[model samples]
Target: MAKLLLVTSLNKSPSLLLLSRTPSAPKLCPRRRCSSRADPEYLCRSIVPTMHYQKSLPRLPVPKLEDSMRRYLNAQKPLLDEEQYKKTELLSRSFEKGIGKELHEELLAQDQRNKHTSYISGPWFDMYLCAREPVVLNFNPYMSFNPDPKPEYNDQLTRATNMIVSAMRFMKTICAGYLEPEVFHLNPAKSDTLAFKRFIRWVPSSLSWYGAYMMNAYPLDMSQYFRLFNSTRLPKPNRDELVTDDKAKHLLVLRNGNFYIFDVLDRDGNIVKAAEIQAHLKYILSDNTPTPEFPIGYLTSEERNTWAVLRQKLLDNGNSEVLKKVDSAVFCLCLDDFPIKDNNHLSHVMLHGSGLNRWYDKSFSIIMANDGTSAINFEHSWGDGVAILRLQNEVYKDSTENPAISPKDMPASVDSSKAVTRLQFQLNNVLKEGITKAKDHFDASVKTLTIDSMEFKLGGKGILKKYKISPDAIAQLSFQVGFLRQYGQTVATYESCSTAAFKHGRTETIRPASVYTKKLSEALVREPSKYSPDELCMMIKECSMYHGKLTKEAAMGQGFDRHLFALRCIAASAGRSLPDFFEDQSYARINHIILSTSTLSSPAIKLGGFAPVVHDGYGVGYQVQDDWIGCNVSAYEVRDVGQFLECVHKSLEDIFTVLEGKPVKG
Candidate 1:
């Protein structure tokens, strides 16, 4: 077998890496540019097993592959080590009692179909953006006066409508999610109750509209997978910088209070943008439909009238009014505006798909078109990209037909979910403290910080020109899969299917979600007590696995409360609603899977070049051929079409390593 060698261009700074495959590094730049080849250095050369330790505790035995295989496949050992039972024995097992036939049926059905599947719903976060919407505005508060469906629009509609019903069926086949549409805009007097339910289906399952309405929030569908919005303008910089070049001016309609600024960075290293400054600017909206009664009550006079005006204003002037209303509206930001020049504040809004918790608030990205003719990689929370593109085509196609279907006549419902279970298991070493104390935990930015000078190895030039992550991530990911291939006939490793959540095979654990949950598991897997920590770790793992698996499939199985598992643990632990606990606990499990070398003591892969920031937030890595990627998507994990080139770089570099797997243990 060949050892798959991989490399990346993302870490292009000196001490980090250069863009070369022949081992010759890129031309070194004297001045450090934050986004340039490598400024902050964290390239350590030594290979240490792990950095985990407690003040003065002895090293606990790391489980062997043999032991792990037994625990994963045969279920040989009880999840909880004996010592765990002795320690937290006083905790109630109320969840066990509540978990009845209903719960069992749900899990069983899900397992039968999506046993080897994993799920992920991306959002607009940092790095690559996962675009999705929480809900659709069936009643475009801002209906355009010129609603003409060009031939292309009709064609898209035709293609999308044809696939929808079948797509729903596909969802069932995988037992990933259900297509349930709830109504929030209907009035008993005249609103079509049945009609509205159908309308909601147009929304991508990523939004979990039912969940959103229940909680009173709206998530942004950044995926634009359907290409629903017209790209009036594409950000183009004469140069290849986000700032120096021009991007589309996204006019938003966030109420002054709906958003909280999470980060504001400038090239010159200053947090120049502020919410207060942003407040001076108007948040624009495409549709300004006024909900006579929304958020569980009638809108105040000011709010109602403001929305009416908002919709009207957008239809009349698009974002022109927004620019007028908000003084901080941008014109042309320059590349010099970052690290050394200016700062841009990325106002972090609650991604309706991830719910109100910040932990699940991942970033979003868009795929660029090679020629700016069509969108290639976009997934919205409200609708799928292909579906949206189809819708666009359908509208155009229908325009040319003898008789055309009206946009209002289309089915509004879409399957927007996957077999995502918030597994009921625990990590190997987490404690209650880790779950409850988020502030004290490691911060992503801090974690991303490098330790020392970035290492620009003066190595062979052939190895320096370009880099790829596909092989690197695959090198690690494939090993995991190959192991499962041997023992995972019944269950697939979490990484098996990257496109959808319902895929199944022999998996080490659930995917998409696993990449992130596992990271969370690591944080929680701690030894806080004098008793044997192993016992607690094992118990937590089992419970988490069972519950997580259950959550992902509730949608596919009828009458299955998605929270069936959460409710169970509530009972098993002799407690109340588990959701209440998550909010109270603040332990978010969403995987912000970023692509980079994991924080293992040193990143000296026996045979490798560089790691790219493939997946963001979750910090997991991924490798792919340039032309292949994205099965399921989120608001924060998308890249413009051009980003795919990196995938090509990755594949070319790691082809050999992929065939070889990893170095055989001594």
Candidate 2:
């Protein structure tokens, strides 16, 4: 196997942390700007203006053929019965010695051609962004912030000011390249990294640049800024057409159910002061006007294919200029009236914005409530949750700790030059009906989901540390044990592990429920009394080791799943159909992912949740704190996730007891 290597442009800076990661020999930056005058932003920001962390970031590597083959065969073991496993094993062996070599060569050649980036960028982008829509709970992920504990920070205007200020400051750091990239310290022995530098740059816009809501795939030539602080103007569908205005210079703010817009950046392109932003938000809240009867934002939550077709119909009526206001806006900011401390209410509002109050297509939108509560409703098309979550966490940190961000420090004045204005859309009868239909679709969709927020007190992660096991692996194994107890077998499971270690790397699947895990689960549930404490300990250790290895491989971009996916994509790109092995029923059955999960651990974030990718599956996002593990489990009506989580909680407790050398309970 090739050791991870990083080569950089002369302009790139060396990361101090990366140097620390491999301290014996350090690579120092050799080039510096020779010009007499430096960039003004660099001087003002008091930070480096280069991608220090990304300079030596390793390129995604092609795994050894035999290693990947063995891993693939092992991954499929848990999901298949004996007969199915044998068939999959046969198929795996055939591919390993046959067409798989050709595919591997093609992947290596592509990686060689694109030395600085991952091989999966183009295919992943099409799959993430332009390929799908309706863009609600399915693809779009959301995070709800903890309520402001301090009364002063709870004021909507005050909080909104802090948020905008913090965001501006953060963006400045990102632009200046002063931010640190995430280091994947998988274990002490080996490590990988993710290029978070792209996260900051990619979270701003470009989700809808192709055609704001066109059903037809007409490629549009529009340059989108990933860091622009402007708003995306989602004008109401004109005669059934959903249009967007991307040329706007201001952010669209919604308060008291009415929309308002003001300049986010001044004429000189510097971020407008937070006081100016607050003044505009306050101006919108001051007036009591009847909320618009047509809340078109709800339409975005309709079935994707349904919305695509309706959006094209809306364009046929042709109100291009009005649509432009919506298309070009950077993102939407909703200054809502109510305090949302309840998880259910928060999830509802964040997932599907209050009917008339959102332009769902914008890549990012912050909904700050009057009581200093807030949540983010972001388009999943642009980037994953890590980037947006980082942004939110930073904004929250600044707001909580920085006294200068307080609205009390504002210069008791408003910017008359940056006046807030409401956008008017001429809605025809068809468009009005579209809004009605969209609401119905949204209501129906919401009714199907049930989200349960749960926490397990395993005496903190330190308990696992004592046993020298990964806490995450235990959590994943607990889910497997619980599911096996409930469903009697493992369904295809998807545990998302980040592959951001490479340039523009997204994620690779870590199939958590392996054959070893399934065997353990079956033993635990079916014959707990038959297994001795030492035997159970060994089984648990084996399961954790299996999960840990798979996780590290995925993070290192050598996971079997994405490599297989890449092969299939390569065949399609070459105008050839996928091989028969891919079409096998066992392949689809083993990859269905009935339990979709990801772990987001941070001291700051309380809960991070996303709807299940499949209707029958459960989307579980968990945060493992020092003493407890908090999980937000969401499922459609098809599954009893609430009960499922209860089983998981009990299973976790049981595992801890067993590990502690206690006799099995019940």
Candidate 3:
């Protein structure tokens, strides 16, 4: 039976039609086809006759269509309203019942933020360092399962995440020192050039802003990052405009209130990506205002030096020192679950004694494949590689499937001795070996976006949507993402490209006059810092010093030279040749995904940032995924618990030493 709903407007006439979920074709009616051309139910339901009238839908004319729609609305209005009323009543009843029950909820009220728990402080987090803008992370839902979350399981995921980011977080002090005393000056419109366009660089307001909204539907297999903001939308429009003496162009908004502006070109280089990225960033600024941007320099411009090459970008600039201020490191630990019944006992044993560690009593995830094997995934935000893996080993060593096996089976002091011995040493030496191996394996297969011709050919045309370009902008970003994943073990995000006058000191700033140069720039640098970049970086910028912070004297060169350097710095940073910080162990390279539209195009770039973990006893630890792009940190550590503890100790020591601007010999 069709459910009834009361709606003042005709919008609710058909409950099925009223639904706003992604539309899927309806299932076929249950009745089978009849050779007699009629079935009793079909006749009673007015199907065959109704079909004739429904067919008229294809022949709609302005007046007739309007009249028919109104008549249809009137016909079903009563039923629709009744259905709406029923649903409202049902919803109200559920609400009242929930309030009346108030059993388990009262306890929850203790932690609730709003009504009863005003004095009870809720989960508070400062994502200012994690992003250019402050972002809030609420742990309530994850922490508030009907049954409490298992400490051990949470520990593991946190540990893995932290391990993956240790090196970058560990060097913040040094990185911050190198980041200050530098700035990128956005050029103002020149006197002779006219005040037609404005330019700016893109920065993200939140990490989720870049991962979720800015690069919302890019090609990268973002099944992972999307989870961070899958259901998130910034609710902010991304658009801006630029005006130069020659013409006005629109821009797009990027992560940090930066604006993006670009021009159409025939090249496969960073130029196109840069232009598009700048435009999109600009658009996000100015509230998606359809303004214009005046052209400046070729987007493919590359300036290798500034501070980014040496890991300065990772520095906090004294912004928020949560990670540096932490006295102890946070660690998460988890063990892989093999279906063997023994493994179940092993999993349980891992939870013993460490009062905080526990198996997720009732948590479960669906297995897309129905094979008998079960996969257990844990989440942790603390612990280094050494501590994490060693913990796993200990769990395995201590487990016994037989319930008959109890404390009686072991010496009275065994449990206490193990815990004490478990952390015998502070940190471990796992990273030394693991990172060496990871580098070799990773570098050999480093596949990222290539700024070459990216084309999508749609067969059997009459493609839906008003997009003129065949594959459209979306297809382009997707193609880039697909290419990156195939060759690289990372995620790609779109950064807004730029559209400003080429820096021509003391001269009337003018957009590039060479279409060929523009094309060459686009074809080669569309996705800079990929395995293959454009020749323009070679042609336009001085590539030698592209490796580190350009000295003040070097950066003080003429306008054209400075622009060349700036552009090169952008490309080199994107390409991973430059470090956002000095002591970074690995490189951080994010693909630039560009969107090309007829009037304006925007490109989105992804930045590597820090992830912090707050744990119960282990404390807090911060990690940076950009270790590969900047630092040479290993993804795993040795499996000795003693050694693992040592690494954490050393890392914390190093973090604080850097914060103090002095080295520690202990």
Candidate 4:
């Protein structure tokens, strides 16, 4: 019965980027603390302090109505037939000249009223908070860290200790305003050097952004960085809210379906000694408690409203103080008792876990399997990948470079038994039933999902560069051809491009399926023999060039999706009837995204992915490296993920062959 409810919820859900470029890591300060503010070390070992340009960052621009509508029509072209296209085009024109103009004005007025944040920030937050589905697959995503270079450091006890210590250092660095500012260096040799930094540091905070811009570098908005610590998303009846308690000093640990809390920060807000943290973690790892019959953590995987009701019951039953502790902890570190067997197993474990050992509501959780493999599964409402990726890179570099715990290190002599307290919940019969039901539903839902990965070593970014093709563009083209070969049709696809270049920016959609890609895919899949290698290569180049344009536009906040969405939101809020454009079938079809994809390529990350947005769609997380292209894909039972991956491999090979001036293999 619980399974049926989960499936029903799944069915009802609106089963609703880029080349792999690693963002530059902030420079770490020297080990010694400087007494004088004028010291070079006190300047973050760079000219500009972290967040130096945040105050001067430009606001995200709302594109013009006609421009957005034009792009929308172009994106809709390849997906619709003659009649359907005509109707949508007419509806779009009517909306643009009439209600859309009014809505745009209203949106501008609202944007003016909210000068502190982006126009889309409020609506975007509401979108995620108002979601009623469980966050497990619907909202939360995971990115796995690469194994440590030192094998011994991968030990669960040692790794968790080092990560926790490094995390504390990162927090301290940010708090002291000494961390290096996040930047995108277009010409690293010129702009990412000490000389450039020394010159830029003298620029006042109000004008620091222009100084960086003048150097052909862009400073990203780091407003979301504050939410990276001491935060959790609280589930309410119809909407959830994010809450943070920076004063909380303890760390939350989940093991064997049990919850434990211990202070990792001192009363003066200093990081506790590493040895003491190791002792506490070692004690937790060595415990032999059996899994709870009704692991309360599973309740976090239930439907949002359901979880809200169950949480209120807990508060009514003398668990309010304990719940507050769980909510206010700096962050969660989940210790899984089982070892992952492979990459697929790692994806499964990290993305959702066994459903018994995860608290899905925390802002972010560092999960360590028994084998010491670790990843971060984060709640999506409070932030995006920019903050999370920066944190992961810094943590990985620090822990690997300056590990505090070694294999021979002994646990501190302190009595961890007295320091760590296992949270005791007085679960009444109703709460117990809720846990059991949640567990059953979560298990059933996950059972229907599939995760598969593929690595193409045949060629990657280096080889594509030789052909003057964009690596990310070629990757998206492969998906188009692969889907065509599998289903004999083109579908709406989404590629995420960050607008972090602007203050309070989120993301804009890059519609990857365009007329150029359609031509390329059809030619490759249907008439490979009709075109010469040169002709096919030309088509490939066209797709790459056009995709690059789309990427730039989306990154600059010129994409049509968000603008249209904001206008629709304005009309809805004003209680005005939606324009004809909103009611068009093409809008619905284009939004039923079938191929939802993103790329985050970094040396510190091994793999990252999320569940498909729709029941029948595929979630593609890929990284295009210098010598290989790796993809981790997920889907529900309705699709053949394995077969789809096979098609993608073949598509890549055929494209590479054409690039090599050879005919497609039969």
Candidate 5:
């Protein structure tokens, strides 16, 4: 369960923080000097530079202590009985008037001292780094790309080659300060146009943010973009540190538990020929090297402290230079030996593979199955989904639209044997035993998890909008109803809301299990015959309205979770006795999170998911499309995931029926 908490703490889903805008097609740079590479025209240019607005972005605000306490008490109500609620309320009131107020002032002073970054950034990083669990299923999550439209482009070698080239283009575009800034345009016609870009470019970098704000456009914090490439999270004794080296010109490739590397960039910072990359990958795929008897990659999946000790041993045995090369590579490319069988199989493969073929420490790994289906499983500590999603969108669009290599194009007539370097590590008996234990432990842990998915086609965002309802709210309501129908009670539910609108922002929690939802769930699940269609419809409208309010507040940094979490951290660091509010059983129960959920919708994403946050909880990665709702659910063997999904499907049907002025049939 502690591992589960770490997963939720870092595994945030894509949120409404970003507007639905398709990335424009890449255009050749006209003003900047071109690279010496053959494909010089691949470089893209933006009207405004990538980090222009970062200096002018507003700092994340800390909510008033009273406001946070009120919100906290409200969120806790649905999960507690009268007696528990009363006692929790008394404890909260006492702390608010006493020690909590003192802690709030301390947090504000700390925030003032750290004006360069968001108040939550350091504490959030500490939360992730301080955890000792293996990150595989605990702190890393996956987002898979939709298959290429042109079936031929889905070939393994071609897709991998094209993606690698597109990724480099993105990296170069950002590093050269030519990539477009990440902005959410409320009215694209007004703010996402050439005129807006022209006007904003003239504004001083220090004042550029005001121009976007005037047009109802928001410029998100792009600080995390730096970690997308040439970054890796290094394990340490009590904490892990993130390392990035932009000078490294190679890409790491893992196949059959073996490591390989080759330079993908030239001295001029231009991408190498795609043909050369294809040829090198082809050679590695055809190599018949037997799987290592003790795969060093498995050590990455071991408990953090154990892996840290083993890593020091590897260094002691003269492996420091090799480890540095692995850490500094631009990114990892995993060529999997197994083909995806179905959507569920794809989810499992991307979430956590056999544990032998993956190096989970890389900032991000582009994994291509034998069948050419691919996904990105990334380390969650350095950044959230916003930066990765942008990369995914760009890579998916560029690789499919402007491929650098085609199937008909033969690999360059260069000897890949001379270009690619296979990395070898000398392992002692202790390290070998550690790797073996890691493999077995990983195998045993993943065996207890079950993943299932379902697609509802009756109605979706479009239909719900006709009734003036929020689609996200309704999706959340369905979960509440589904759980009540299946398990006979309401539990704490979490939906992540991104605060990227602020400088160095991370995420805030949206507590979806509100009193409105509790009432509606009971009405629909236990006594459907007692209420008229209009009555039930009215109840749904209320729930949607309240859920929308929660979403907006969370997005605006007015939510209580982060504020309370920061205050708690401040209190604990004060070297004083902790407040009773922190020790209340209700606090533990609320944070336990039985239904941990997140959602992401994009043309680039076929599906995405994370492991359950608790032993008895469900991790729901959902998307509400125009005419359908899709969910990928994961849980341990303690819960019946299949039955839960069925109940969710039924819940959606019932909600849709009620919206159409019809009674739900039992």
Candidate 6:
């Protein structure tokens, strides 16, 4: 779901984010360390050197024009009525014979120009960065970690310190080029030849792709060189007001409705142990006020373009110095001690700060609740969720490997003389009024969102295994059935399957609401009594297998949507009259994602996912585990999350019963 943005102003830290686990920390991969070079298995595989990954990786390929057009037409059929389909077909044929030929040739020319990167790179980059919308749930995605088991470890300071150490290690791994290259399944049947692809440019070669995915742990104030500072996204209008100083190594601590900064790196540019970090936090926790009269952070919740303008005005009106101090800090840590333990509530705070409690622009924030629950809220403009998840998986693993140090374990020379620096924002009456307005806007906007997180014990993965079906395919098919049952029609669905099978690959659209999907769901819902359980099961299998086939195609970078998007871009670039196909109602109808879904599988992740993409749609992040299936369903006031979850549950049960040869009830 991540696209690179090519803006000069560096807001996103192009790096891996974070992940989570409970008392027993989870491991991402079973291989503890690199196998012996002398081993037979190690010798069998030709491992490329880390530094040469880019050189070894192949460039993203352009799909055949005819193949893409055929798939595109087939995808549009289900979303359009017969009359609309006829019009779409006529327009599509005209384009295939006329303007499309020229555009394809132009695209080939553009591909030659950007031979190193894919044809979609530049356009994808603009789609993310050029837009002025605030990257919250609409853009930036987030995932909350399971609550810390040890009460002492749950302490905000303790958890934050541990997380930082883990983050440092993760960064070190990236720098050392030891991080494992991601491998996505292209086609399970042809898995031998299409095994793995090195997508991420570990060390970007040039400015064109340089800093495109650089995960800079933002710096604050530094006592030494190479110290990183935390960059803060100040609340303003029209643009993102970034406050960062390269010299800063101090951590920005947000708790009890206030901001504090303290050095996390020692004078020698090494991470201070958890004990010292905790000591600094303990001092701040004492006698801190629970509320702030003016929450300047709330100003960030305003519309992005508006914020850019307002921030510039504020800078001119006299808050530049204070803003600098707040901006130039290292990473931000929020001590959000909320009463609710629900994942939805935690997710809400992490995605969009709990009203003045966070500055959401930093690459990553340590969100620690008073109950010791923690998660990371990050800017999605830079890295994808997997990048961040890799870091988190490391952190979760380390939490167990190196348990929190005792106070006695702290060094005798630990500095206690330097007090935590409280960041003071010099807000005039006008800025203060703007903060009030921002708070109102944030509260009103959030009030309309409904998030429902459910962990169903139906054992979806196990059931799928019993029936020999792909978990992902079944989950998606379940969503399709649920939508049809709830809305009485198949809505346009966007399912993100990895395109990490090629160099610099991101994601491709796996449209879930297909013609076969509709056919199967319609049969299941409307004429349940008309067919035998075996007959219905066979039809469902056909739909799930079709989904699986499309998913594999999407992963291989041969999907229809991106090719169509590239064609549209090409036509626009050529200054040619847009084809009638582009203007067809079918185009818009199929592109509007009513059900934005993705399945992230990890036994360690208890509750993991993102919010809805559109206001009236649902963002369904489901974890299809072995025993049970967990989902975090988010929707706006227009769509009920609870109702959607109920429909999904009913659909899964109905489908599962049919597959199990059980008679349908009622």
Best of the two (2, 4) by lDDT: 4
Best by TM-score: 5
> Model 6, 93-116: lDDT tens per residue?
888888777778888888898766
**Model 2 misplaced regions, further than 4 Å:** 1-47, 53-56, 178-249, 304-319, 403-411, 415-418
Candidate 4 accuracy as TM-score: 0.93
What tens-digit string does per-residue lDDT give for candidate 3 at 1-666? 000000001110000110000000000001111112121111012111111111111110011222222222222222224664354334334432542123223323332434321111111001111111111110100110110022332222222222212211211211222111101112212311112111101222122122211221111110111111001111011211111111212111111211222221113211122223223222322233221121111110111121112112213232123211110111112223222233222222221211111111111110100111212111111101111111212122211111112222222222222111111111123322332332343223212101111112222012212212121112222222222222221122111111101111111001111222223223332433332222432322221121011111111221122122222333343555432221111111111111111101101001011111111001011111111111101111212223323333333232223223343332
TM-score of each: 0.25, 0.82, 0.16, 0.93, 0.95, 0.83
Which residues of candidate 5, in runs, are more than 4 Å off? Answer: 1-43
RMSD of each: 24.2, 9.9, 34.6, 5.9, 4.6, 8.1
Q: Per-residue error at 250 for model 2, in Å?
A: 1.9
Q: Which ten residues in a row have the lowest lDDT in candidate 1?
A: 136-145
lDDT, candidate 4, 391-467, per-residue tens: 77778877887777897899999999999999989899999999989989999999999999999889998999999
* Residue 216 lDDT, candidate 5, scale 0-100: 74
lDDT (10s digit) by residue, model 2, range 424-474: 666689888988988887777778888887789766578887898777778
lDDT of 5 by residue, 170-231 (tens): 89888988778877766667988889999999999889999998997788788989999999
Cα RMSD of predicted structure 4: 5.9
> What is the overall TM-score of model 6 with all chains considered together?
0.83
Lowest lDDT 10-residue stretch of candidate 4? 1-10
- Each candidate's clash count: 207, 25, 148, 2, 0, 39
lDDT of each: 0.21, 0.60, 0.18, 0.80, 0.83, 0.60
Candidate topping lDDT = 5
